[model samples]
Each structure stands twice: as structure tokens, then as C-alpha cells.
Target: MRCKYPIYLLLSLIVLSCQRKDQVVKRDNEPDIHILQGEDTEMNTAIENAQKSLYKFKEAIESRNPDYYNFALKERFNTAGSGGEHIWISEVQYSDDKFYGIVDGDPISTTEVKLGDTIEINPHNITDWIYIDKNIVKGGYTTRVLRKRMSQKEREQMDKENGFTIENE
Candidate 1:
């Protein structure tokens, strides 16, 4: 009886200490995996707005020949990734119901991101977007001249004032 009790105790301990090894789980109310679409709407709207804002800014810079240069938009996701201040998103585009971004000269087409390799995230993983504008400073150093997130309404107003139409196709 004592031996049986110790075996049961050890088995219980092992089971309690173990965690689910799968990245996804099947539930009665939830799916086996988290699909990117139909999960995040705010992020989708934010990205769309960011795209519009960038388009307007680029057009203005080109037409007016602004001194500012090297402007880009970046996004962060909820997926597991290394902690860093430098966000690596060069571009974001939609293909096959998922958003892909260029990070560090490579395209990220999946949810899991590799270490030191900036990649796009599933739409559901997106947390926020950053609009960055870098300008050449003294000593040939590029400084962040502008960094902020604009709301969809704000972008719309700016577009109207600049005589730009945001045509999403």
C-alpha cells in the first residue's frame, strides 16, 4: 500500500509539473488555432489608416521636396519575440488573408518570429503601429524628426486638407 501511494504521488507530481506542449489548443468554444483574420478589427483599421497617412506624407514630400527623408511605418505583434527598442518593419501588405511585412531585408509570412530576424506578424498578433521620419542631422547622424501614431479620423482630415484621396482597392 505504501509503495502504491508513493507511485501515485510521483505520477501526480509529474503530471502537475508538465505543461501542454502544443502551440494551440482545441476547445469546444474556440478553434484549434488562432487564425489571424476575424480576430482583430482595431488593428486592421489602424493599419489601413497608417497606409493612407503614409501615402499622403509621401506625396507631399515628393511634390514639395521636403528636407525630411527616410520615413517608414512599423508594427509590433503579440507573438513571442525578443525585447528591443528598434522595431523592424519596412513594409506591410495583405496577401492570402494575412498581412506580411518586410523586416531586416526579409519577408515575414508567419506568426512565429525568429530571433534577430524582423518579421511580420499575424493580424491578431499586431499590437500597434509607429510612423517614423528620420532626417539628417549634423555629423551625418540620422535623427527621428517625427514619430507618432495618427488616428483614422485625423488622417482623413489631413488627406482632405492636402487634396489627397485615400482609395483602398
Candidate 2:
């Protein structure tokens, strides 16, 4: 029995170590925003133009064509005050004048946020809104699945160079 216990302990340790360290375990309530698989750096970017209306952003998300735009939302301050900016990876969905979406990936918050929870964003205090539209290559097109982080400027530059432009309002 003692020898069996030792073998079992060793097996458990090996199993735990084989698991990916970056795997994010979410709670039961939150929505599932499965942006990427496996370990990779989280996405973050600062939105340069605050004057733009949310309508533009809303339209993009609701269109349901964003198969390659993965992003992370960083917390911010506004009329809502602190703790309002719950940082999480999510894809926004607009319906009935309210933005609804799921947590796409792990969040930077200590609070318990599940993978498929509804996300709320104060239309005004949004920061770090960086993403890329679908990609088109020579003779064919491809979805933007590369887990690389890009700045707002870089994203815009890539858009223009690729002949794909996201309207700004």
C-alpha cells in the first residue's frame, strides 16, 4: 500500500507539471470569450481618439465578421469612477442599445470573472482599443490568428497598407 501511494503521488505531480502554466481557469458565471488557445501574451493598446462615438465600434463588433480581431480591455476611469474598468479579454456585441459580450480570455482583475460572463463597458472611458481586421494575402486570404500585440498606430498602418480600413467616427 505504501509503494502504491508513492507511485500515485509521482503520477499526480507529473500530470500537474504537464499542464500549461498559462491556462486560465474561469468561474461558473462569466461568459466564455475564447480568443486564443494555448499560452501567449495578452493584447493591450491605448485608444488615441476619445472623441469618436461608440457607434463605429459598435457597428464593427455587431457585424459578426471579425474572425481575427482578438483584444483585451484595460480598466479606466470616468463618471462611473474606480473599479468600473474591469480588465478582461472580450468581444463586444451590441443589441437593444446595450453592449453585450463574453470574456474572451483571462482578466487582470483579482475579482472572480468567469469565461462567459456578460461584460459592461461605459461607452466613454474606453482605453486601449486595438485590433486588426481580417487579412488578405496574395491569391488568397487568411484570418488574423497570429498572437502578436500591436499598437494603435501599427494597427492603422497595417490596415492602410493592406487596403482595409475601419471607419472612425
Candidate 3:
């Protein structure tokens, strides 16, 4: 237990020491632009959540298999997956980029991605990549595949926005 205390102290110190201290470069005095591409984070949520809420809404209304869903939704389900192959989606247009948006807010974080920007998100892995559409959502991109690689500062920023805890690495 005595040795464990030293290791714990070391970890805590390591976590605290390397906070956000560096800065991005000044490009024409504007913030450095980061092009984020690939994978929708909200899609990682379970299909059943959408099925229960989204499709269910359309299904109940139309009395048929739901291929149509609402344009804005905020569903909380524990599926933790990119909704599988069988899901049909409504397109959310952000200038040109289309993302599978939830019923609540926009899908592609507009503040994050810009049009004509070449960004890469490894949906499956870093080596595996797909070209992000500046105006459309790729249907086959699974939530698991497009793993979000959040930078330290970005993660902290998102955590603050979402009111969640962030672990800095």
C-alpha cells in the first residue's frame, strides 16, 4: 500500500502538470483552422434509441415501417454504436456538409468543420480512412469506425460544453 501511494501521487502530478499551455499559430491574426472530418459522434448512440423514438414516431404516425424520422431530436440510449446498416436517415445540410443529425441539434459541429477543407477521421482506424463529403453524410460510416480522436484542448473544450468530465492525456 505504501508503494501504491507513490504511484498514485505520480499519476496525479502527471495529470495536473501538462495542462493547456501552448498556443496555436496566428494565421493572418485569425485562429488556426482545424479541419475535422469523418464519423458522427451522436451516431454512436444505440439504434434502438432512434427506433424507439425516431422511427417509432414516424411509424406510429404513418402506420408503416419507419424510414422517415424527425429532423431534430435528442435521444439518450445506451447502445454505444453507430446505428447499423438498416437505418435510413434524414439529411441535415450545413452549408454543404450533410450529417446524420439528431432531432435536437445539428450533427456535424459546424463550428468545428469548414467546407472545402480536407480533414480525416479514422472511422475504423487511423490507417483506414474515407473522404468526408463537404455536403453529405456517408451512410456506411459506422459510429465505431469513425472513432473521434479528440485533442487534449479540444476534449477539455467539449467537456466544458457538454458538462462532462474529461481526462487529459
Candidate 4:
């Protein structure tokens, strides 16, 4: 039984070591800084690629042809996320008319709507700009919180300097 205990412990350590080695390395060019800090330097390199095929989807509201973002939303989804993640475009039938169609991605996911505010269905509004960024953050794009921590005192001073104030507390 004593020998069995040490053997069991040894097997556990081996399994753990294997898992550590097999961890999916997420980056190719840069050593993911959060995982292996300061191991690789940043590089700015541009790679050219043509856009992906766009699939037309149901538009919730009619905005004419070009104004509808169903094409671009699919394109953004293809570019930003793992392709198999099942992206779909949805047109919000608005009783409160803020936005019409949204790529089923973050930033778009929570942004509010306003009545009579029609989206012209252009690429700028349709693009899931936060999609890649939100996904990469692991804990879902709480970078704003980190920024608050990093800039709290500086921001507070700036607010005071700029005549922005908190009166009571």
C-alpha cells in the first residue's frame, strides 16, 4: 500500500506535466504575454488576404439593398471567430427603434437600442469590431475594468482639472 501511494503520486505528476506541455499555444508570432511574460517582442507585419464569401440572411427591417448589413455581418463573423462557432445575423424588430440588424457578436450583443434610430446597414456599424478583442480576453473583455485600475488616479486628477466633479460623495 505504501509503494502504491508513491506510484499513484508519480502517475498524477506525469499526467499533470503532460497536460501542461499540451496546453494550446494560442499565438504564433508573439508569445502570449499573459501566459509567458516578456519572452517575445512585438512585431508589426501586414498580411494581405481577400474577403470571405458573404451569405445573405433575413433582414428584420427593410433598409433597401445596400443599406442592409446581412452581408457584412457574416463577413465579420468569418474573419473574427473560429469559423465553426455558428454565427447568425438577426434584424431586431424594434418596438424601441435603436438598431436594426446586429451580428450575433459581443459589443453588438449588449449595446442598447433607441427608437426611430435606423441603422443605414453599412459595414462600419455591422462589423463586429469587438468580436476578436472580446473573445481573446478570456474572461470576456473586462479590459475596461483593467483600464480603470491603471488610470483611476490619473483620471480622477484629470476630471478635477477639467472642472468635472463629484459634489456629494
Candidate 5:
């Protein structure tokens, strides 16, 4: 996804576990962005966990809880040929058993959508969900996995730049 500041800043923070060597991209004007491999076991597990606990995000939205803010979902969009990239959609709304949200960042590998575009979310394509609670991040399973791959300095920089702390649970 296209990297921006603040919330979308996290969109570019992708890394694989140290056990595996993943391609890491360094930009002069942006944070290091890593491309995750689909075969990674840890990432797969994170996605599974995120899907299993998706109800929490849905419930929070349904309740209209003020404390729960910045609700988003990461969904995989297919490329023209094969494979797909997971992009985050923010300002999510659920109604009639369907989800709708705005694309939070620009596409890196897929041309199906772009930043700020409203689109219907397919439940099966959802890989992760997140919301902020009292300045702490909740249900960012994939994000946590990616963060674990960063160095201590990188993690600290991310925490400082993102304006939210993701606690280790």
C-alpha cells in the first residue's frame, strides 16, 4: 500500500520473521517496508487468529462505543494474474450483514482499488482487524507479527510515530 503519515504509516511496516529471509525495501523518504511471504507460518497463524476474533471488532462498531475508534480491516485484493496484497480499509461500517469502508492507502501490487475509495468488504478476504482503545491498539494480530520482526529501535520509532502503543499480550 502507498505509505503516508500517522495511521497509514503502519501500512508500510511489513516484515517477516527472522527465521526466514524476506525482501526488505528501504526508502529515503519513508520507513523500511518489507514484503511478507504468503507461506510464512507465523503470518498465517496471525491471520487465522485475526479472523477468529473478528467478532470483537464487529461488536464494538455495533455498540457505537466512543472509546473504540480507528476501526479498520486488512483485506486481500487479487492482482491481475495471481496472488494478492492485503490492504487496510478504515472507517468501517457494518450493515445488512455486509461491511463497507474507505481504502486507507494506495495500492502497491493491485490495481483493483486506490486510496480513499469506498468498497464492499468480503468477509473471507479479511486478514486482520484493528481499533484503538484508550490509546492502546486492539486486535492488530498481523501488525503484532510484523512488529515482532523489527529491531528494538525500529519498534520504538514505530510506536513514537504511530501515536499509539501496541502492548504485548
Candidate 6:
């Protein structure tokens, strides 16, 4: 099945901006981009942690807490020769061992999917999951890692833009 969303790019863009200290220009609504190495141990560990704690996200969703909003999941999509990208899906629902959500961002690599497309995802493919509760970020394991990579100023800006606070873990 084909998947879509450039949410990974959006996150990476934030991280990249911090690392490079470069101004991001959004031309024609194009997403700012960042590329991470496959062997980045920290990032890999973050993904693993997110998968391990996925049950918590599922439980929260099942609980139907009104405070929980902006639920999103990240999945890896493989292309023919360009490897794969980790993209985010929003408005997620989980049932019968499957996930349904809309692509939350425009893809930077794969063409099989695009923003606002509905897709089914296997749990094994989920690299990350997140939701907001009371203007605070929860279940954003990868996001925490990304935040750790940012400077204080950049982190503050990111938090302000997202309208959520990601406390230290």
C-alpha cells in the first residue's frame, strides 16, 4: 500500500534549522527539509523507545480524553531506489491491529501519497506516535530527541510555534 505525508520533513526541518542556524525559506509552500543519517544511534534509539511505549498512546486514545488532541503517528515508506522516509499521519485511529489516519504533511521524497490522503498502517511500520494534552506534548519520544538537539532559543521558538510545551524527560 502507498503512504503519504511530509511531517517527517517538517520535524527534520526544525531540527535542521537548529543545527545549521540558517533561515528557512518557504517557497510556494514547500516544506523545509533535513536529512539524517541512517546510522544515527540517538535517533534510532528514540524510534525504538516510541515503539516500546506505543501502548500508552493506544490506551490514551481508547480512553477518549477530550484533552487529547492532534494525535499523530510516523511510519516509514520505502521507495524503489531512494530508500525510505519517515512521515507523520494525523487524526489517527487504531482498531483491529491497524491504524487509519490522514497524511499530515506534503511528502519530500515519495510520490505514492500526499497530504490529506487516508492510509492504513501496520504497527510495525510506526516509528513514532504523539498527541497533545492540555497544551503539552505527550508520546512524542522522537520529538523529545529532536528538542534535545536544539538550542534553548530554537526550542523556545519551536514550542511557541506549535503552541505546546515539551518538558524535559
The per-residue C-alpha lDDT of model 4 at residue 93 equals 33
**Cα lDDT computed for each candidate against the true fold:** 0.30, 0.34, 0.24, 0.23, 0.77, 0.68
Encode model 1's per-residue lDDT on 111-146: one tens digit a residue: 444423534444433323332223211110011111
Per-residue lDDT over 46-165 for candidate 2, one digit per residue giving the tens place of the 0 to 100 score: 133321433445555666663534322322322121232223334554567765555443443334445456677555545333334542221100012221233568556555544443
Of the two candidates 1 and 2, the one with more favorable lDDT, higher being better, is 2
Per-residue alpha-carbon lDDT of model 4 for 51-116, expressed as tens digits? Answer: 111112223133343322212121122222222111223333323433344433222212332222
Say which prediction, candidate 2 or candidate 5, comes out ahead on TM-score.
Answer: 5
Any runs in candidate 6 off by more than 4 Å, and if so which?
1-28
Of the two candidates 3 and 6, the one with more favorable lDDT, higher being better, is: 6
Q: Which one is best on lDDT?
A: 5
- Residues 35-131 of candidate 6: C-alpha lDDT, one tens digit per residue: 5665667877988999999998898888888877667888877655656666778879977867899876677667877878999976887888887
Model 6, TM vs. native: 0.80
Which pairs of residues collide in candidate 1? none
Instruction: Quote the RMSD, in angstroms, for model 5.
Output: 4.3
Q: Which regions in candidate 2 have their CA more than 4 angstroms from the true location?
A: 1-45, 48-53, 62-86, 108-114, 136-169
lDDT of model 2 at position 105: 35
Q: Return the TM-score for candidate 1, rounded to 2 decimals.
A: 0.26
Candidate 5 Cα outliers beyond 4 Å, as residue runs:
1-5, 14-21, 27-32
RMSD per candidate (Å) reads 21.3, 16.3, 18.3, 22.6, 4.3, 6.0
In candidate 6, position 159 carries an lDDT of 60
lDDT of 5: 0.77
TM of each candidate vs. truth: 0.26, 0.37, 0.19, 0.17, 0.86, 0.80
Candidates 5 and 6 compared by TM-score, better number: 5
Sort the predicted structures by lDDT, highest score first. Answer: 5, 6, 2, 1, 3, 4
Over the full model, what C-alpha lDDT does candidate 2 score relative to the true structure? 0.34
